[model samples]
Target: MSERTDPRVVVLTVLLQLAQEARQADTLDAFAFVAANSLKRLVPFRNAALWTDRPARSGVSAVSGVAEIDPDSPAMIWLDALCRHLAEDTSTTGPMGVRPENIPPELEPQWTEWGGPFALWLPLRHPSRQVVLGGVWIIRDTAFNGAELALLERLGEALGETLSRHLRIGTTRSAILAALTRRRLAIAAAIFLLALFPVRLSVTAPAEIAARDPMVLAAPRDGVVARFFVQPNQMVKAGDKLFELDDVDVRNRHELAIRDLAIARTDHKRANQAAFADPQSSAELSILANRIERAQAEEIYSRELLARSEVVAEKNGLVIFTDPADWLGKPVKTGERIALLSDPEKVEVLAWLASTDAIVLRSGAAVRMFLNTAPLSPLKASLESASYEAQMSPAGVLSYRLKASLAEDEPPPRIGLHGSARVYADNVPLIAWILRKPLATLRQLVGL
Candidate 1:
């Protein structure tokens, strides 16, 4: 086999070289490398300077390794103008705009200076799609034939494809790196939130007021039934007589005893006087005085019996219960209870709550209570540091007693007022709402 030296072969070989150059350069610096190396194989200007045109910019980097030249240099200015023309044409006519024979007069001077009569300006397309993005100007010494021009066009195409591939890779890599950085910041933000905002814990329960039951008043000794002066539920002051028993018999006995006492006194005085008058008669007088003293003792006993007829209240309260109204005229036994009284102003609100709903109940919890009849208003209350012993309600339902005290501004909750209380507990994590019951059950069973 013989190596083909035909122009077509040359063109194909050079185009392949250009594509390889672009593919090899991964970074933006590879642009300089690609332009420099790819241009070396073709017959172009002796020394090539890559010129990129902005509004007023000239030559940027040189492929021929020449000394830096002023951007204002005539040759450099012409090169920039040529690049600008190529850029404009490619923008309008797509990537195949620049060809060797179409060189304008103003750009000729720069081509001549760079040592090329025919040159090709190829546009580097963006990685997104096939289009003329920027121009790649090549320098050649002589006017090239159609075959050479065709070769340069093919080289441009390969360069465009390669550049597009690299641009896509660069864009994708940048996007991935940005995404990673963003994710890291998000994680940090979550951690910061956890530290700055902490969860709080608190105890909660319903409350109610409690009072001691009324003290019992009972008879201390056996006595006849007294005549009652007041009816049930009547209020009485301490020391006021509540009932009076018949004392006629005891009163008569007391009067007889009083007369006997007076007679005893007279006899004792006579005995003493007799002893002073005559020693011989003193013994008989003393015997009479002894009998008088025995009679006087009986009189004192009758008087005491008469004084026990009246009954009195021990404390101030309404008379809660009275057995039979006619019992006042009958005999009464010792230790018999007369009445029951309870404090009125110091009453408590006994709120019954379902056991399941009372799970959050705890001492010191704050609550708001509203009577069933007074639903429009609420009274503030606090847990009274105690709870009722758990028991079944009258209706056979499990419930707990919540004792609450009215706040300073509120009136004491009247006894027997049916009301409900709302207790405030600390906020918990949102997830706990679903898991609260199961967790509580587990803890109870495991004793954890």
Candidate 2:
């Protein structure tokens, strides 16, 4: 039995050729190429083309037997339109045969113009579903017999499976498209929310509560803290003794000035009485008067120093020191700090925004704080001020100081309480909010 005469031999040969090409194909384009050049031998055609309608792509992939239909030719456009019309209905679950006679009357003129004067289309669909994958257009004069159609019908299933197997996109695009389209209302709602809704563009930072009126008492003059009148955090009233300076030295000086003034005044009075009796005594009286004036000035200064010996609270508040022992016997310079007189009720949040994340924070921006002690019960506040310069935070991270005022009605956070805060800033789109950071990072790295 000759190969040409034997239908079984021809079919087997064509199958082997197609299998080899199928194995070599890596993409949808390559698969389409293999189908175009190889399938014609079994179902002979004068002109043939393969097309697909996958995501992000649509049009002809491969052509065979016709060199006349070039890219710039009008025939390509007509062919595309013709195939698109046929592929509109994806219910063609499997490969289906069609002849020139089956071509709809509305499409006949176009079919004659581009695809072919006489042709057949084998519409291929997803192997497992009703969705149309693509089709093969073959131009031939002879009609397909039962044996030829049978051969193609038996093999079309495998061909569709091969197309599916080789396709990189697969059903993922369709699935996503279906999800987006089926829940169109949800998509519209999301778009609407993104466009109209004003979300907070917040910057998170480490924070703590600080007293608004923190009165720090500094040493009036050089002295050692001789004694502490109260313990740490002890509540005190105005004029209450807070601590005492080592005033023994100051007292001695005060006594010396007082004794010196008394002696100078006594001497000056004697000189004045003598001035009336002797001319030399008048010169002595002038010298004594000068000495008496110097003594009085000295006396006044010494008394002022002695008065400052006892440190007192000028305003009402708790002593804001951790340990009284820290101040005991410690020698301090003039104007050296001692302790803070802080009203626990008068407090504000001091947040440190990282240098990298800091933005132009306006006054009265929204602020939400969460203390380490009470993470769940968030306290609300508003931005009061932001530092013009960056500084190192307590943790050593470079940050900008941001001030905020907690709502008065909300329980005032304890003075010196540590926490974290989110400072709300300028508005941005929802997509921008999600992607801006990543895009910014990418631009920095890639310099795009």
lDDT of 1 by residue, 331-414 (tens): 666678765555655655556565655556566667777667686898787666445566775556677766666677787655
Taken over the whole model, the C-alpha lDDT of each candidate is 0.61, 0.78
> Considering summed lDDT, which 10 consecutive residues are worst modelled in model 2?
65-74
Misplaced by over 4 Å in model 2 are: 1-198, 276-278, 435-448
Task: State the weakest 10-residue window (summed lDDT) of model 1.
Answer: 198-207
In the order shown, the candidates' Cα RMSDs to the true structure are 22.5, 13.2
Model 2 lDDT tens row, 326-348: 88899998898888898877889
Candidate 2 to truth, TM: 0.58
> Which residue pairs overlap in candidate 2's backbone?
none
